[model samples]
Target: MENATTLQLDPEANSNQTIDSQEKILTGDRATGSLHLGHFVGSLQQRVQLQYRYAQTILVADMQGLTDNGHNPQKISANILNVVADYLAVGIDPLKTTICLQSAIPALAELTMYYANLVSIARLERNPTVKNEIKSKSFGRSIPAGFLTYPISQAADITAFKATLVPVGEDQLPMLEQTNEIVRRLNHIAQQDILVECKPLLSKVSRLPSVDGKSKMSKSMGNTIMLSASEKEISKAIKAMYTDSSHLRVSDKGQVEGNVVFTYLDAFHQDQDYVANLKEQYTAGGLGDGSIKKILDECLQELLKPIRQSREKFIADPSQLIAILKEGTERSNDESNDVLAQVKKAFGLNLF
Candidate 1:
């Protein structure tokens, strides 16, 4: 109902839709953090819609979790169920979408180890995300080995599922490129199309900035509004949101150029005409950030109400939720194993 989501356009939206292409997709989040508005607007929102349309697979990346936060294993483990809860809390149906725990599959680790050799230390060093995160986290001298090798691990995550399309933000373009490089090398060496080249499924709105006006919204930064938040919680969070550098006085003409509230409205609010009207009002010197935030809050509450209720329903019966996840994991393994077998044979690993 909120615009035509990826699910709407995906051919796997229904059983009746053609299953012609092996466009099996693998995408997911690191259970290292909470699900935020940024996650929804950027990836999960599209994913929820896309799953119905494509042969979609949603992975709970606990293995990737350990790569960086291996010491915080329990923290990562606790978030697993919470992350899945958030997934189902959205529209990611377990029956239609394969939701697997990444740590549960040993084949992925094996594949990752193999792909690791194909990449160069220089290539990994050039990865923008790795560089940024390492500097930000101040891991200059103490970088973990897994942290350095995450790009290869990501390639395994994508190829193990034989995902033809990988939904990533622009920041992740390098990672997708890395995965395709492996695919090319493997396919060429084997004299067969053992791996499929993946494309970046960048959404028109690629990412949501943090509410505090940082480059990206992050859980650790404390600038997020969770999809499962109550109306009161959402309102409180919006009221406390940071705005532009100027606009100190009530009557001072405010700039909507980087206002978090307006940004959120533009990304999440579907009433385009209303958004346009609000933008005009704010720019023309009549609208207050408070006024805009009020409407934004209402729109967000309407969006979150159903989701919160759905989350509550799922929480009421934990066993049913586990069963759904187990079913999805089983289905995912069946398909991923086929891709793994092909990769192993191409590398002559099956000779053993």
Candidate 2:
């Protein structure tokens, strides 16, 4: 909707358009911890589907992680490989999707510094995601400047790769808005159409609520089932899942609304008929939460078994894992440095 470029549409043309071969997509997760089921449903699954259709670049955003976890470099460092393993385990083919480390790309940091001036502190303060995170972390008056400005960094990341598509949840809409604002401003100022605008590929299953039936799934809240969670852990988490609190007995009428187990089944299970029947039986006053939980546990265990196995195999080879990251990082540098050089030349900073 926010436009720096215009599209010339033919009045008689067909509505459907073919995807461009050169179109690129960029997506990533902060390397603060291992990914969980929420990540799978929200973005990773979409990435797998998009890999062959577009040139995809997946970043392990360690620099962004430092915005919040600056005090714990060890945690960020350890989780880098874990996140990459999660990507591979979930069928992200490295040959098709370039997986890179954010810290290894110096061009991104430089771009961030330049782009920061294009955005105002007042605008950053108004960002809903940043505001929500500040409240969640209770940063009241001690909010880190880096955390507040990470949106600029994110804008830089997207434009550095000239990404045309970004997979994100509904809550991240504000962030994409900010990114496009900067993109349009930069291209206008340079008067040369330098940067590209990106569209958000909103996930169908945008979010999965917390296991305890809270508003969202979060690792910090201890309500997430890790992508590589053991069968035992999956069993325990599913068994402890929140259900209708009023249904105290097996014969008591249960409410399907706001039930966590059914929510998960709706997301993960392909057998819609069975899930529908389960919901119908659940509300009919004779079904028990334990029986529903057992079904969910088995479904989850079977779903995650291969993912856990693949993760373990990747983790066993530290050198090979590092090599993959290093290669991807090098490729990122080549791509981003070209963009950075163009940006510097546009600003008259490349006066050599």
lDDT of each: 0.79, 0.87
For candidate 1, lDDT tens digit of each residue in 1-352? 1111232234235556554365667799888865878887777777776765677888899988887788879879878877888889988878778889888777788888888878899899888888988898799858999988899988988888888777766677788888889989888878999878777776677467777776566666667888777788899889987765676655667788778888888887878898998787777676677788889888899888998898888877878777877787787777668878888888887875
Model 1 CA deviation exceeding 4 Å by range: 1-22, 248-250
Candidate 1: minimum summed lDDT over ten consecutive residues — where? Answer: 1-10
RMSD of 1: 3.9
lDDT (Cα, tens digit) per residue for candidate 2, span 1-352: 3422222222233214343576789999999899999998877777776775678899999999999888988889989999999999998988878999999999999999989988999999999999999999899769888999999999999999999878776678789899999999888778887899898866556378889987567777788899989988899889879999898998998998899999999988868799999999989989999999988988899899999999999999978889988999999999999989988877779977
Kindly report which residue pairs in candidate 2 clash with one another.
none
- Deviation of model 2 at 292, angstroms: 1.0
Per-prediction tally of clashes: 7, 0
Residue 145 alpha-carbon offset, candidate 2, angstroms: 1.4
Question: What does candidate 2 score on TM?
Answer: 0.93
Against the true structure, whose lDDT is highest? 2
